[model samples]
Target: MAKKHKPRVKAPKTASPGEVMEIKTLISHEMESGQRKDRKTGELIPRQIINRFECKYNGETVFSADMHPAISANPYMAFYVKAGESGELEFLWHDDNGDVYSHSQKLEVA
Candidate 1:
């Protein structure tokens, strides 16, 4: 079976110059622990999770985290960054299935 990818992000459309902005992100994933059994066959489900998450502003990394299966379904993340005149905020998620999901937001500085 092929891996699936999904991503979500929340970012302000604009911010004042030199101001700080908060960003939130989440990815839809099963986060299976490999220990879980299939309901029908009682077979162990292979572990699957979002192993890494990163945020970049104009190509510079601002925040990042190494996630594990213990996190939760649909891993959620929140972080802050300083906003300057106009730039792009990029979010990335790497899944255990070797799939990478990414999303980006562009904003204006007031």
Candidate 2:
């Protein structure tokens, strides 16, 4: 059985008007690459990894990335975005197992 996934996000609660803010994200995942075999069963493991990642600010896409099996477990990403107004920042990670893990944060610009 697969373990539950936990996602973490880091962003400033407030930012200066039009200033660039750094965003960091990380998620717990095994990120199986499908290249190994079970020791007992001797069967090839299936590939299961976070295939995509996206970030949206104020309902608009800000940063996005396409990942592959080469990515390591517990993937971490850091990016930058311009602060706009008070709104929500949504982060999403899509896995090969049809699972979508998400997290959100509120940012206020002064």
Candidate 3:
């Protein structure tokens, strides 16, 4: 599947080891509920939402969520994580159509 938009992330490029850091993420998604009809065709549009989201640091998953239809479009998330040396922060979003979107950020511990 084609990714509609890239995921947004916020984090310091470098931090002291063991320091707590805040992370923010946002992804653009339609979050359809299957109740909406196409404006031009009037055909019922099937539900399409990001079913799941996962955050991993250095290959270890630290946070995850199951998205529901009630979630608004362009989901936003914020969380905290403890820094431990150098690692990669990976974000993943799974859509209802078996499409997976992912983005990664590199972290450096001072």
Question: Which residue pairs show backbone clashes in model 3?
Answer: none
For model 1, what is the alpha-carbon lDDT of residue 75? 88
Instruction: Estimate TM-scores for all models.
Output: 0.86, 0.94, 0.87
**lDDT scores of the candidates, listed in order:** 0.85, 0.92, 0.89
The lDDT leader among the candidates is 2
Model 2, runs deviating above 4 Å? 1-3
Question: Tens digits of per-residue lDDT for model 3 on 1-110?
Answer: 46575788887778899999998999988789788999999999999999899989999998999989888899998888899979799999999999888999899998
Q: For residues 1-110, could you state the per-residue lDDT of candidate 1 as single tens digits?
A: 25455677889989998888888887778888777999999999889888999998899888999998789888899889888768888888988878778999888887
Best by TM-score: 2
lDDT of 2 by residue, 1-110 (tens): 36567899998999998999999899999899999899999999989999999999999998999998889999999999999898999999999989899998898989
- Error at 81, model 2, angstroms: 0.9
